[model samples]
Target: MSVAGVGGFGLGRPRARRTAERASRKVARNVGVPLLSIVLLLAVWQGIVVFFHVAPYIAPRPRAAILAVTQNWSTLWPLVLGTIRETVYGFVIGAALGLSLGVIMAKVPVLQRLVYPVLVLSQAVPIIALAAPLVLILGFSVTPKVVIVAWIVFFPVTVNVLDGLSHVDQDLLNLARVYGAPRWRTFLQIEIPATATPLFSGLKIGATYAVTGAIIGELAASDGSSLALYQEHANSNLNTAAVYGTTMLMTAIGISWFLLVVGAEVYATPWQRRTVARRTWRRAGGESDG
Candidate 1:
């Protein structure tokens, strides 16, 4: 091969190696740091329990919490499944309604004027305060829990969607209008895509809140088989380890649900991801060249 070919091969190999190194570093940053932090946290927790001679009922050690989960897995698994179902149902119903309302309000000035204040006022009333009334009216059933979750999710989704819609570039919109693009066509093509990021931001926030809403709803109602119910039982019985384990499970569920939303967002907006990756690569390449 010519000297040019040899030089090209040398450069290509280095670039490939750099790319692999970057990818590995990214993975380590994402996964390794979190794992290390958790291990450190557990160590500190165990140390505190041992050093303080803390009673198990007041503050169970990390091992005790893990034991609680393992020992009660048969009972806990059903409760976890129940809570997951409630969270999904609530998130779907809430997201749909919020998106619809946000779109309608954004498109119609009259609707915005009439409805925005009501929406703001609705959020002013604490969801926990309404829990008892909802239980009384809807009874201690899944319906009430679903409604509570929907209520918690609706505000964030609506507000983010409205913010997204409002921020659409006026120049782009005017250009579309000047080009004789139909309002609906322009909105479908331009407005929706432009707003996708903010809308998903809202959805992610709602997803995080969904499980908490379900838990709160369950706690408000007396009879139910959910993590919240299990927690309440554990608290009453002074099974602190079980209470901690239930909490950990709920937190894991919430994180999983949030990540699912993020995955959906990434899938739905491939262009956005590509754009981000390009910018990141450019920045990295520029730094290296410098």
Candidate 2:
């Protein structure tokens, strides 16, 4: 083999090795650190309960919470499913309405001036304060719960989508016009793609809020088969382990919804991920150089 070929192979080997090292480091930073932190937190929690002889009612140990979840899975699973269904329905409805309104407002200054202030004002009245009224009006059913979730989700989605749409590059629009592109074509090609990241950001926020809203609605409606109802029962009975377990379940649901939104964003906005990766790599390279 030629000396140049051997030199080329040597350089390629180092590059591949460097890429592997970077991937391993990223995995450690993202996964390993969080796992270690959770382990440490559990250890501290267990130690505190054991050493202080704390009553389980005050704060159950991590093991007790885990046991509660395992023991109550038969009862908890149905409630979890119910909450998930409500959340999904509300999120979908809210997102659709928010996206439509945002686009309309962005396209029409008159509508934006008329509607934006009303939205802001509506938010000033706390959601919880309206929960009882909603239950009264919608009856003690899933409708109120779904409405509450939709209401919680609507504001963030609308605001983010509007901001994204309104901030789209005027230069790009002008260029499209110069090229004789129709408004609809330009919007499809440029505006929607640009708005995706912000839209998903709003959705992620709404996703977590959706779970909270469903719980609040359930509490207000006194729904017997919901997770919130289960938590309330556990609290009243001084079953702290069950309460903690239910809380964990709610948190898991919210996080799962958030992750779904994140996954959608990553899929929809590949360029955004590439841009972030480039920035991360550059920053890491600079740190190494320093």
Candidate 3:
């Protein structure tokens, strides 16, 4: 009934329309930016190849790579699935065992001393060098692939977690002692939380290693069902395009696995999420104030 009420009603429609337009613009930017960037990259690549007269054998054009993927879809599907299955199984098993070992090594000084050096030395050994023996010992079955992947994934996670445990704030430890907290309680409450970032860092690295290890295992074990065998055939036939396509597929798989682990890290660390939210809110508040 008031003048203000009348004015609010009159302005509300325009405000709503403006809000919708802003939101649509934001969505368009989000979608369009990535698409435009990819288009530009492909265009540049194509132009370079055209100017240089790059042979397909040396580097397939983006169109050829795409065509190879589409054409080989049926042939590559099973091999892709097999590689994924092995990588996943290995990641889970390796993470489980490695996390347990890390916990033990960190909590007990004697065990830490005994195991840490061995873990370090094992990492120093060339992974590829061990591939043949692994195949010989475990055969071309899934066992060797899983073992190799686990071995590759284990060391990084173990080292990161152990370092995290070691660096848990002594002040926090003393505070826990003052509160009459048990050793395990202190570890769960203070140590593990403090070490979570490093642990996740290791996990992310290990996830990529898991994929690489699985590929290596496939190469060495030479089972007919694996992506390595697909590569072997492609290499033999000199279908360099297909080989490049398969490599791209492997790269995509690794990237996807890394992103999955990153998602897990972001989900597990609420402090990180809240920190980001606060920074965004502060930035918005500053802009509003300005």
Model 3, span 41-111: residue lDDT tens: 88998899889999888778888987897898998898888888889888988887778888899889999
Give the per-residue lDDT of model 1 (tens digit) for 1-290: 35556555544432222366877998899879988998998999999999999999999999889899999899989888989988999999999999988899999989999999999998899889989999999998899999989988888888998889999999999999999999999999999889899899999999999999999898897485778878988999999999898888998899999989988997787776353444533454465552
TM-score of each: 0.85, 0.84, 0.81
Question: In what order do the candidates fall by TM-score, top score first?
Answer: 1, 2, 3
Off by over 4 Å in 1: 1-18, 222-224, 275-290
- Whole-model lDDT, model 3: 0.83
lDDT value, candidate 2, whole model: 0.87
Of the pair 2 and 3, which is ahead by lDDT? Answer: 2
Off by over 4 Å in 2: 1-21, 275-290
Q: 223-249 in candidate 2: lDDT tens per residue? A: 467899999999999999999989888
Q: Give me the displacement of residue 281 in model 2, in angstroms.
A: 24
Number of the candidate with higher lDDT, 1 or 3: 1
